[model samples]
Target: MIMTKPRIAIAGASGFIGIYAIEELSKNFRIRALCRNLPTTNSLNSDVQWFSCDLFNLKEAEIAFQDCDYILYLIHSMTKGSRLTQSTFDDLDLIIADNVRRSALKNNIKHIIYLGGIIPEINYGISRHLKSRNEVEIVLTCSGIPLTCIRAGIIIGSGGSSFQIVYRLVKTLKIMTTPKWTKSLSQPVDVNDVIQFIKLCVGNKEVYNKVIDIHGTELISYNELIIKIATLMKLKRTLITLPFFNLGLSKLWLYIITGIDYYTISPLIDSLKYDLKANHSLYFNNYIPNPISLNDSLQRAIENEEKNEIKPRRKTFEENKVRTVQRLNLPMGWDSIRLGKEYINWLPKVFFTIIRSKVNNNIVRFTFLKINLLTFEFSDDRSSTDRQLFYIKGGLLVIKKDYPPARFEFRISPHEQSAIAAIHDYYPSLPWPIYRIFQASFHKMVMYLFNKHLIKIQNKKV
Candidate 1:
């Protein structure tokens, strides 16, 4: 009998850990990347396939993970912008995880491997963050698939959230006043070791339905880890711990100094109230024998960051709202044709729209040929661009790239004689749950059309 490499679907392939997981796992498994957006072809393995998907939607998830036997569950909303509060994030994580569970079962997926937090042994000191992580595990296993949970503490590696937090704190501070929580014990694991352990679990019956503990070579407090990292970087740093600095103060310090979002870091700080040393973890030695040491992992983490090997794991809400403005000058003004009346009229004659219908308004609309009508509404934005209006999209902060052109009716001197054209984009901010996966080339197409229109107006050759 010819044996086939089990097809594995990665639900969050665009994330930092997810991308690295794909790169390492591709050699052994047939890879399928399911993400909110399509990645560039060159970034994927030749045999790898991509499915644009939104996990919150079960229909999309079913299609994305179809025909795959195993799932590498790397989705987490701790840093996701849509997750406003820790409570909100916990609810959202449960919803998304449950959706994945249902979809995985629908697709007949057999096993799921999850990377989650290591909970504190004491039930009384359990945090909302830890509870959320536990809930995800519960939801994943409720679907009846064997869920392999790899509980990790602070992960020390380049591009990792936990590592980045420590790096920023150490790199930015010379003399620091840290909070009381810094003294808590933490066992951090290397990114490479984490990846290797995940690789070892594939097709392993021993790891099924198991909760494994994976950490660094030794346990240390955050204070010691900071000092070690500082020594490695050859920096002189002084640390004074104060119990009075509460979570609010710590959150503010991280926000103001490190420039990381305080909302995301706040809950994590809350969870750090207790020690995060792993206990009773099913020994990973069942598969892989060697684990990377903290010194080597810390050194490699810095080297990777310095070498620019780190890529962004997740996007803040602001990244989704891409805005672009292109300006054009009509050296010779329109004589007979006023504004784009002629151009607008000319579009229907040549432009290929999927539908032959449109709504009549102040803003002219051109719909693209797609499953959904991608309509570009061109209206005047009250500027030298022969436009006088900009409408705000649903809760999106509309940014006009250039300040509404500084116009002075009271002439200090003769203004330059030219018709200025400007473009504006208001991308609506949709909640992550219902977001539909679509091609990203729409932005580039807008620019291409804008430049082409300028050339045409200049009476230049094609």
Candidate 2:
């Protein structure tokens, strides 16, 4: 008999951890995402159902989880309490958990998975931050349903709070005066490992009704972590430990030097006051054996930042004009002269041109196999190949009659040594998901055609 995929509901789906968890878990299970605001993402999977919801509204929460078999909760408020009123973070956590349990009970949900902080080594010395996490776990357990609480220490991954703090401290100062918190031992786990655990524990019986403690193999102090990070980045640094430094003073100094909001840093530092290692290592039946090392995890974080640094942010506009551009070097730079400008331009050798304010209505026809298979034209086609450089601007980019509707911009710029092109397509008319499949190839083809035209022009061929 063929088995049906389970339905998993992800609460707080807009968080960084929730976002990644959805990507990982969606492969084998149907996913339902619940959040107050729609996530700002263009690469969302087609199979997932995203619902905008306010969890505090019991009716709304129950409706959202009506069909889900598993619930994965990954949300924690940093500011804590009621917005205008001063309520504690722990209190707010319990309130949210009660709402989730009520909804789960109404929907007959089977499992609840939560990612929480590991308990502090000292019995009663738990920081306010960790206490909130522990209290949340207790709230979930009160529902009388099977719960899997994967407790972990500072997660070392891209965009994680702990990693971001380390990044700011290392990037800002070469020489620093730190407090005793820097000496506390910590067992940082990789974000990838967290994802691995979530994926494995979906319907596994061994992890049910258990509070599992997870962490990496290495046990290092904050001072050591900073030193290793600096060395990996190839920087010189000096650290001075000052025992007299006050917690309030440390938070103020961090806010001033790093420009990180004090609200987020306060509770984090409080948690760092004690040793933050797991009570004991976890061994699940379906666990991903042998997580990656600390060095590898740090390297991954750096790589993620480097990629985000160069990605382009799309702009909002009245007309839905979407575009992707790239720069590349062709093997031959002198081909523009032979087939660069004017006179048929051979295969086609035109460089960049300034786009006119408005588009022109002109029709150009191309015949194929004794029949007019394709007929199209650009609004403006003033060709140029001066000094092995030219561009195509304000042209009719008709791909078959009725296409592009009307009003589109096409620009091409070619220099003595390089070329650039920006192709814009109407959002509603273009096949976005289909186009994404060939985005890389499209970039390569643009470059290929630019260079090939020069060869055809020099050979005196059409």
Candidate 3:
């Protein structure tokens, strides 16, 4: 008799850790990699199954998790997912986590293993990035499934954004201007060790429904880390500590030297103000007795880069695409479906009656002076109490051929007190400058007014 391995689905399988994970975990289980785009080559692992899915859509997430026994959720949206994103990373992370939670419950998965950040021992304040990670943890836990969340700090690996910032800073600057946040302590774990920790947690009954922390053997300050890296590279670097260097100046200095985007660097800098170390000491120590050292991990990262181990990332979005997400207060008696209907009904009262809206059967149209400006067809099959989706069917404001029509959606948040009105993959028919100047501004103004309307309703109920 032959034995079959348990099937596991990996979200964010195209990322730095995800790519390595697919190679290592495929030897033990049947791997199904969920990504936004399929890999051009099957060289990573031919046996690994790849499913292209946009996790924002619940139906897509459900289909991606089909027939999977365990889930490895490694998704993060530090970089914008669309060409134009009007939402914060925190909200973006929350929505994606909710989708993952819903999909996991629908599929009846056995376990979910999530990779998150090591929150500071002092839980009073944290960076938005870390807060977002914590929010994702909550959403996944609320699914009533067994979850093992592994928290780590400053992953040292090839192609990792955090490590690359450190590496670039040391290489580029001969004299570094240090801020007070550099004095904060951190335990930088190696990516290989993270992968090993994940491997041990899968199907492990003892670690189920627990939060575990993993870190490198050495605990060093960020200043010490910089000096150590300089020694390793055989470079003589002078560091000048500036007591009064504010967050703004620090961000600018790092951005200028490391060339990392503000979106990726901002929250990371915010996190450096707090000491980040592993609290659980012996939980998984038996499995990984000598979790890799800082010196050796740095050496490995350098070697991997020298050998060109990093692969090129495939482009995920087309040019001229736009995504706008607006969060509004949900009335006490309102669900997402109700909020969506109210929006359509309120359109006629907008812009001093210049805009008109009409709904016929499943189709909806918005017009100016009886000339159609936009059209949407309600998706009956996709509508639910928590979410309502409308397909951008046609109108003067849309292109003639949209392969899969762009979507306009209203979705309730995890806590149910708020809702989001979002437009995804929308490409305007107007010219870029014209759309940016007039159409975009008009859309935002309309949403702002709608938010005000909701607030008034809530006040009345009070």
Candidate 4:
């Protein structure tokens, strides 16, 4: 009994989950990747084909899904803007769903598999990210296509946005001032299991027109998840929940601390107010025989992250020539000499002047001051760096050359107060003034001589 591989088309094939899904399904399926960017790796099996097509464009989407048996819709627009509003999220969902439905109908695609959020309720406290997921599910269900929607909670994986945030926060913080939503329950699933579920849904007649809730074996609170992560990393953490902490304010705080965009964090924090625990009774009765444990999933995720760290990161032409001077000890009052022209008097004064520069061209033209701290030393070859350390801890970006890295320990200072005023004057839209000030302080200026320079520093050895 010889079985032939099904021809499957994956939209948003370049995304985190999409890439993982491709890796899992590529061996058993003839894949057609529909993405905005062309596939970078030539290592894809010969059975895979790529089409550079924007999913928002209905015409292009139609062409992309042509002759495909199954269509996987795994796209979202959280990173496109500063705020993920409910209206904006809904609009994107409607647009994607309509376009996908039309394309599927035109191409006679047999089935459509959509990955969406598990949260049923939506509110101001709920993140725009989760609301968007809910909207996408509605659109797919209403569409004429036989849609299989897999509603999943936080997916715990190495490179996933949610997991990355938790991993970094847990690894870095010792005393955590978390919000009330830390007690909210969520059932996170493994990335591997998510891919498996998607693969199983492909052309499965029994599950073709069903909405399944998928999750890991454990139902734990955000605080518990943090504790588990800290335990895994062998770090001691003391958790303190602030009763009056504003959710939106907390998101802004997290953005400053984690270097994760506020737009993404806003929605994630909103979703934490509700219980995202998945009811796996249906899944157990219908889908697989068993699901993986949270411990095992976390272990795999860490391994994957370690592997990713060692993997060679590909950079653009502009990124390659950009030199990163590690822990360069710049003396106080260090002046910039650019092509024999003196740009500024000293490092601190120059930084202050750079912040005051109101001109847009002036902002992006010269080299910006960039500061980062080496936080976790995994090995002699590998170490973790946090770019937003100063900002997160309410420390101002001080102007000093030859400042030792050890002097920049996470703390709050009076200079942080002055930094806020400077940041607000320059970048008004930045939510937390104090945080932005810290970010701007440890700045790196790339001289115009290397305008198109791109540099990648590899700390991990394969």
After superposition on all CA atoms, what RMSD does each candidate show versus the true structure? 18.1, 22.5, 2.2, 18.3
lDDT of 2 at 441: 58
Clashing residue pairs in all predictions, respectively, total 9, 14, 0, 22
CA displacement after TM-score superposition, residue 350 of candidate 2 (Å): 85
Q: Report clash pairs, candidate 1.
A: 380-387, 380-388, 380-389, 381-387, 381-388, 381-389, 382-387, 382-388, 382-389
- Indicate the TM-score of model 1: 0.67
Best-matching candidate per lDDT:
3
* Candidate 1 lDDT tens digits, 378-447: 3333322333333322112223323332111100001222222222223334443333223224434543
Worst 10 residues of 1 by lDDT: 405-414
Q: Candidate 2, residues 1-462: lDDT per residue as tens digits? A: 988789999998877688788788889888888887676764457658888876644457888998899999987766422112123455445546756887898799899999888887665977888988887788788777799998887888766767777766887799989988899888888888888888888877788888888887689999999988888778888999999997888888877766655667788888888887777555532375687799998888877855665221232233333333322232343342333222223222232321112212454332333343223344333323421212222222223334332222222222123333323232322354543446435544644665565455445632
- Stretches of candidate 1 off by over 4 Å are 1-3, 80-87, 309-462
Off by over 4 Å in 2: 1-3, 41-44, 80-85, 284-286, 310-462
Report the C-alpha lDDT of model 4 over 93-146, residue by residue, as the tens digit: 455565687678878888889988886543455666776686676656655678
Best by TM-score: 3
- The per-residue C-alpha lDDT of model 4 at residue 46 equals 83
**Error of model 2, residue 183, in angstroms:** 0.6
Residue 159's lDDT within candidate 1 is 77
Error of 2 at 331 (Å): 83
Model 3 Cα lDDT, one tens digit per residue, 301-389: 87776588443344455678777888898889788878988999887876667888889999899999898998998998988998899
Candidate 4 similarity to native, TM-score: 0.64
For candidate 3, list the clashing residue pairs, or say none: none
Over 4 Å off, model 4: 1-4, 81-87, 121-127, 310-462
Off by over 4 Å in 3: 309-317
Candidate 2: RMSD over Cα atoms?
Answer: 22.5
